[model samples]
Target chain A: MAKPTSRADSSTASAATEAVLGRGAALRGRVQGHGNVRVEGKLEGDVAIDGCFAVAQGGEVVADVQAGSLDVDGALEGDVTVSGAVVVRAGARVVGVVRGATVSVEEGASFSGRIEAEFDMPPELGGKAAR
Target chain B: MAATVIAQGITIEGDLTADDEVVVQGTLRGKLSSRDRVSIDAGALVEADVTGASLSIGGQVTGNVTASDRVDLVAGGKLVGDVKAARLTIADGASFKGNVDMDV
Candidate 1:
């Protein structure tokens, strides 16, 4: 059998600005930084990052989040403000207000929140008057 | 592999509980508890009371530490709090300013 090398390579490829909250771990506090963070466990509190933030499957986060971008594949219950896009993947459960450049909720994802996205309309669509 | 890793450039302030090993390469302020080994890597800054099965510090820690196994302060490590463990070792070049209790 060929050795599984991709897993090892990907783990080593993680940059210094990347952090992981693995499964079986729980944190009740505030995480603030200029790096990306992936949550695979339980987090309760506040998260403020200048980079992307992701919540993996089986993960749970109950806190306000401010990030460059947000991706959820688990459970998130808090307001989120992102400078980039907010993607609620399948099987994800998200609640609270979401403010981002773009917000997309895929099928199978449960989201109950108001979305605030600012985008420019095309000229053919009545432009700003369409608002 | 450690389950929880606080990577560099990140700062966490609060309580952290884990059933598995934890590795810190960032800044943490609060309490840390783990059922397994804990490692404070070089360049990390920890200002919290730490409780673990075993601990190895190569960075700067400014709180009391309690370990069921052993505690090792490697070279370049700096600790400024009390230590309670069964076995403890402070390597040369490590700076320590705390009381040690071997539980004899």
Candidate 2:
């Protein structure tokens, strides 16, 4: 068994502003905040964060997510909107409509969703871009 | 380390169920049920019903609490609700206004 005091100290030292949903835990509701959040368990609801959001391996999320950035390596099933980049790593399973400034999907990942990335077109190609 | 930690600056408004240890240092406004230990650290705010095997409160809680093992309200903790546990302790400097049921 780990000491509570030591664990608290270490967690604070590592990610003082980040929130974590550790393994073996599950939440059913809404999570909204301005700090970074990482999930390694199960979450079913709506998530709206002003900072980065990540879903680690073994994690599962079923919700509508809005964040600054998103990193996924587990299972995600929802509509995602991010102001920054969205990276779907290998071994991830995602099914949703993703909208971000940039989207990158790694090999070996299972994705069944629509990706909309907003970017400016090169001048040589077109001076203005249309959706 | 606790299996689940609601770190500072985060707010969760729903139901949380954990099979292992859970530590809350932020805000929770719903229901919390854990099979293992539950810790409410200082500066944390909880406005929900809590159930766990054991619970340690060092923050502010405004709801009913049920513990199978024990419930410890440490110094600096503030609770305004009912408590149901086999063993309970309220340390000095802790503020509490609630009913206690020891099952007897």
Cα lDDT of candidate 1 equals: 0.92
TM-score of chain B of 2: 0.99
Error of 2 at B76 (Å): 1.1
Who wins the DockQ comparison? 1
What is the alpha-carbon RMSD of candidate 2 to the true structure?
Answer: 6.1
Say which docking band candidate 2 falls in.
medium
* TM-score (all chains, Cα) for each model: 0.89, 0.90
Number of backbone clashes in candidate 2: 0
| Clashes by residue pair, model 1 | none
The candidate that wins on lDDT is: 2
- Local accuracy of candidate 2 as per-residue lDDT tens digits, B33-88: 99999999999999999999999999999999999999999999999999999999
Off by over 4 Å in 2: A1-14, A127-131
Q: Which ten residues in a row have the lowest lDDT in candidate 1 chain A?
A: A8-17
Candidate 1: stretches off by over 4 Å: A1-17, A123-131
User: Residue A38 in candidate 2 has what lDDT?
Assistant: 89
Error of model 1, residue B88, in angstroms:
0.7
